[model samples]
Target: MSREPYRARWAGTDYEASADLVDGRLHLRLYGSAPADGFEKVAPGRFVRAVPAADCSAVWHVTTVCEWHGAPFLVHTAREAELLIEYTGGDALHAAGLGLERIERGVYRIWVKREEVSALSEKLVKIVSR
Candidate 1:
């Protein structure tokens, strides 16, 4: 990925989510509200929709994913606030490189590797002594 993973962070929260376009398709991975199905056309060049938590499984992780192939457009939504992402040229992935190097075009392989790290961060906690 690039410096920024095409994401949306609202209200100084770490639970920000991001999205990318793979071969003219939307690949959204976020830990908040599940994006709505399809965009509602508000005007000739505007669309609006909601990414609500419609199911139990969608409560966490990236739950919203869609595919669109045309002149390209933008998705405007939020988790607890408003966010925006434009699906246009360069934003869409044409190819990817994994273990064996660059994979073929239009081929997307999702290999999620999970590792266990106990002390990953140090956050301030309110300590009360009695």
Candidate 2:
């Protein structure tokens, strides 16, 4: 397993994350604050209207797992929209020789061969760590 750091722009926002290639899977952990609108945009309309953060805004925590080269890659799933945007912009799967598909609204999936995936993962780790 190798640890790597990556930064990119998503949904007009910048994010930082650490990635690891383990057992042929790419594991990602994203770090960032919640959107300016806060939980009002994320939570149900009724819930947001009823409950507002008076003292402190709600923080965001997202976790997602995707298959990479037949291996499962676990990712911090915060910033759903932003992550999709970045993926489309060719940041995550760029040059990984992976096939990208839109699984659903604001969601995407990637497919790649094991050898290519391993090579790309190593390259990404080196680039980000530098």
Candidate 3:
């Protein structure tokens, strides 16, 4: 599925990053210098940069399951995805609690509408300014 990239500004640094979810993978890239400052999909919320900048050594994994209400919840395991409540039961009642979208049979990805990143940026600005 095609999707617009999610852009985010670093909380206290002059750096920015963008994430893209494509073909069941999340790709992230930093616009500034950092350990892992390349365009690649590593882990859900982790990045690693090689010391030589060409070591090409890294590993990443996404969580396929999460805990909610003491129960195992199947999730698509992506930085952009939320809790997939379909496993419990694709019933309307469950769907209402947490928006659920089936990515495939027996697998689902949580639905989190595009958030207003600007609002979060503003909040970060306040915290940093203090």
- Please give the CA lDDT of all the candidate structures: 0.30, 0.35, 0.35
RMSD in angstroms between candidate 3 and the native structure over all alpha carbons: 12.8
Clash-forming residue pairs, model 2: 62-77, 63-77
Worst 10 residues of 2 by lDDT: 47-56
Per-candidate TM vs. native?
0.17, 0.21, 0.26
Q: Rank by TM-score, descending?
A: 3, 2, 1
Residue 82 CA displacement from its true place in model 2, Å: 21
Question: Residue-wise lDDT of candidate 1 within 1-130, one digit each (tens)?
Answer: 1112233332232333344465665444334333334545545644333332221122222222222333222222333332222232332343222221123443233322212111112222212111
Runs of candidate 3 with Cα error greater than 4 angstroms are 1-54, 77-103, 108-130
How much does candidate 1 score in TM-score?
0.17
Q: How many backbone clashes can be found in candidate 3?
A: 3
| Maximum-TM-score candidate | 3
Q: Comparing candidate 1 with candidate 3, which one achieves the higher lDDT?
A: 3
Q: What digit string (tens of lDDT, one per residue) describes model 3 on residues 1-130?
A: 1111222334333333344455555444444333443434455654532122112122122223344433335443234533223244545445445544656665544543333111111112211111
* Model 1 bad stretches (over 4 Å): 1-5, 19-30, 33-102, 105-130
In angstroms, give how far residue 83 of model 1 lies from its true place. Answer: 30
lDDT of each residue in 1-130, candidate 2, tens digit only: 2222454333344344444565665444433545343323433332111111121122122233344444435432323222221133334454244455656554445443333332222122222220
Question: Which model, 1 or 2, shows the larger TM-score?
Answer: 2
